[model samples]
Target: MDFAFLFIDWLGKPLWMWLAFISIVIALLVFDLGILHRDNREIEVRESLALSSMYIGLGLAFGVWVWWQLGPESGMNYLTGFVVEKTLALDNVFVIALIFSFFAVPRKYQHRVLFWGILGVIVLRAIMIGLGTTLVSQFSWVLYIFAAFLVITGIKMLWIGDKEPEIGNNPLINFMRRRFNVTDEHHGQDFFVKKPHPATGKLVWFMTPLFMALVMVEIADVIFAVDSVPAIFAITTDPFIVYTSNIFAILGLRALYFALAAMIHRFKYLKPALAIVLIFIGSKIFIADLLGLEKFPAALSLGVTFAIIASGVIWSLIKTRGSQEAHSNGG
Candidate 1:
């Protein structure tokens, strides 16, 4: 076998580097599904936290390795991208919760939906990142477009504040219901079931509510990616760093969803903080141009990003501390 091709550069990184990253992801997925969660059960907050922590630790360790091998600049870029992507994905958790709730999906079946949804996300993000890298490499000015878009998005977030999506009125869901044979109730962990058609009395494949929830979850991620893909590209244009950091961050976030969804209302203030982060990230290019620097400092970006996200989390925890109790007590 001619393995020399592995040494060839694909997207500003050795082909093997991409392969190694893919291999790691596959192993993680296998271990996650084949071992850790082979059985369908409700993932408790404690278990979710532990799984999320392990994924986060592994992601951070990967950044350290990138730093050691690729240089501090690339390492810092990965960390920044990872942090930004993960923070942005918090909003995604809320949407997923809404989807599951609207569908009335069983807690035990939610993980299955999320697991498959993550698989779809991996593929979808790769395509988006690849297209983004191509655009940026061909036209350097596209970064500015992404920057401007991010700035506008951030401003919109600030102005609009947090609004729950009207999942019930979603056109896609309505279209799917009209076009496909969908079951009104869940069928355990199965996404599809063979059932007799109501009109024909013939066996047909019908999608369960579980499947509907999964589709909605995947669509929600794609919607969020519109903001996230550009945000990460604004950080660095390296496809390897952009894609790896994205997948890792998402993997951890999905694991954390079980816990976050239960307490999402407590983090009411995170949206504004995220808005600030986006504005800061988007403006970095223009700020650098104004200051006559080649680019924004990676270390400074990382530091500022961490500080903003940390402050938002702390502020949220403090402000919403008793809201949960109030709601529980019907106060």
Candidate 2:
């Protein structure tokens, strides 16, 4: 077979780079599902932390590779995008927990839903990032819109603070229930199960609560992506850096969910920090324009983003130490 196509450019990067990233993601998923978790079981917090750490290590290592292969600027952009995406997804954890709780999904089966949900996310993010690239390439001014949207969203987040999503009142859930043949209870790890129709007394396919939970999780990611995609694009319009950093960050965050979901309430200050980060990220473009610079310094952006998130995490840990103990004792 001719290997010339591999060097052909696609979305501002050589096709081989995209293929390599895809191959790595597939291998990681196979290892995670086939080797590590062939049997359905609850992921303990310690195990979750370890798995998440491995993913994070791999993500950062990929950044190092980008640094060696690309340049320091690209590396900084990747790191900043990764940090911003990962932290932005912290809010997603709370929503996932709420989805699982609302659907009454068993702890052991939660990983199944999330694993499948990741496949959906991969496709969804690709579509979104692709569209974003197209728009930005064609209409240079669209970045301003994205930047403005981020600023408004950041302000809204700051004003609203942490409000638990009203999962039960969601229209999508209601619509699914009204439109689909759904079972009132979970059927093990199955999203859909063949069963006799209740009214017609004929064999039919029925969606379990597990499936609904998975759908909700997918939707939640899409919703959150609206914020994160633009945020990353603002950092670097290079599709390769944007997509790779996004996937890596999400892969790690999904692994981290089991640990974070259990203690999501402890991160009380994180929302505010994330809001500030958004405001900072969004304002960078305008700030650079005001300073008559082509773009903001990637190093400064990375440093500021890291410091803000680290401060939030540290502050949350300190403030919630007593709450953690109380929760343990109460449980």
Candidate 3:
């Protein structure tokens, strides 16, 4: 049974329970903004690690509980979707790090902007999940289309290797720049510049570089969702599964961004692995109908994907280091 069927098959609490869950999520966000993260500063490693662990533990705990309540199968589906989304999101981290460096974002202010930026992404992806769920339920063929998109995306990623993203000429960024009196310098993690500085009272003051960075971040997220949403669809067509898993994964992203930022360059081969993972998922979705294999269990897929990513990352790190050492020592 696939996601929609699984939704019916799995017994869940009433609508009120779901409402309560959403309410709690909102409360968490409020607390994060109002209390936990009131002061804007560079996130410390220990704090980042704690939040990352907490978010991950919460997701896994929820998944396990779901497994106990629903069955191992659905639990696995949730985990699979979460893992895929999480791994794919790692690529985003690399780009974000580059963006920060490119714009010369101060370490202290980085988390402040990213925290809000990720919140926006959550809202956007939520809408996409709802839309995808509706579309997939009504038309079984939509799965094949999503599969095809992923395959094509994978091809593009592999064919175009080791180049910086071309965000400089993005139409939206250009247009926004032309219309607004954007500040050339960054403004302490402020996404938008309200107007002239209160002290200066000058008309030249406008949007800041941080705002531009936020737009770039959102643009990347949109492009990424195209590939990621389909990957999740392959795992399960239930919109709830896709949305919940994605949100849980994303909730940890800010912390992960900080924890993994320094090591991102070390995992140089991550993009190719992501491309391969996308192709794997896409092919699975595309061939399911042809093979009369309606069910591709999540645990198997998750295990295989994790192994592939780990191997690729480890190999790349070792090779990169070996090359540098060889050059230095004349081996």
Candidate 4:
């Protein structure tokens, strides 16, 4: 086989680059499932933190590799997208916890749902990014629409505060419960089990609560992607960069979820900072137009985004410190 073909370009990137990323992702997944977690078991906070650190390290390392291959601008764009996606996923963590709680999924089975949910996300995000890439390529003006949407979303997030979704009354969940035979209790780690049907009086497969949690998690991912995909597009329109950054961020999120779920209150102020970040990204286009500049600096965008998120986390910790202390004392 000619190695020359591997060096050829696809979507403005060498084919090998794409292959390398896929190879890394596969290896990581294999290590995660086949090696590190060969058995289905409950993940404790300490173990979760360690896994999270490793995934985070791999993500940052990928950014460095991109810097070496793609140049500084692309590198900074990847970093920015990674940071934004990772933080935005904090809200996702909250929802996932709620889904698990609503379904009464045990801690032992939560990882199973999350792992399978990530698989769905990988496919779903690819389709969304591909569609986005095609749209942006055909109509450059769509960026403005995305920008406007982000600004509005950010403002709404700030104004509304954080209102948790009422997962118990979700129409989809209700429809599923009514339409299908669902077990009232979890059946170990299985998503489906053979049980006697109520109407048929025969053995048939019944959906378990674990499956419902997985479906909810997948739906939540699609919803969050609406905000996250546009947010990354504002940073860079390159499909390869956008897609890779997104996948890396999401890959680490499962691990991050375990760590964050235990202490989510500490980052209460991060949402406002995220809102500000969105507004800044949305307005950069207009700001550049006003200044007669071609584009806003990627480095500066990354810097400002880091600063905003950092400040929010630090401030939240400080503000919530006394309350946390009081709760601990009461406990």
Task: Compute each candidate's TM-score over C-alphas.
Answer: 0.97, 0.98, 0.86, 0.97
- lDDT of every predicted structure (CA atoms): 0.93, 0.94, 0.78, 0.91
Q: What stretches of model 4 exceed 4 Å from their correct place?
A: none
Alpha-carbon runs more than 4 Å astray in model 3 = 1-13, 194-205, 321-331
Return whichever of 2 and 4 wins on lDDT.
2
Query: Which stretch of 10 consecutive residues in model 4 shows the poorest summed lDDT?
Result: 33-42
Which residue pairs come into collision in candidate 3?
42-108
Encode model 2's per-residue lDDT on 39-142: one tens digit a residue: 99999999999999999999999999998989999999999999999998888898899999999999999999999999999999999999999999999999
| Candidate 3: tens digits of C-alpha lDDT, residues 70-166 | 6787788888888888887888888888777766788878877787788899889988877887788889889889988888898899999778876
Write the residue-wise lDDT of candidate 4 on 126-230 in tens digits.
Answer: 999999999999999999999999999999989988887899899999999989889998889899999888778899989999999999999999999999999
Q: lDDT score, residue 73, model 2? A: 99
Sorting all predicted structures by TM-score, with the top scorer first, yields: 2, 4, 1, 3
Q: Which whole-number lDDT from 0 to 100 does residue 144 have in model 2?
A: 93
After superposition on all C-alphas, the RMSD of every candidate to the true structure, in Å, is 1.5, 1.1, 5.3, 1.1
Q: Give residue 32's lDDT in candidate 4 (0 to 100).
A: 80
- Candidate 3 RMSD to the correct structure: 5.3
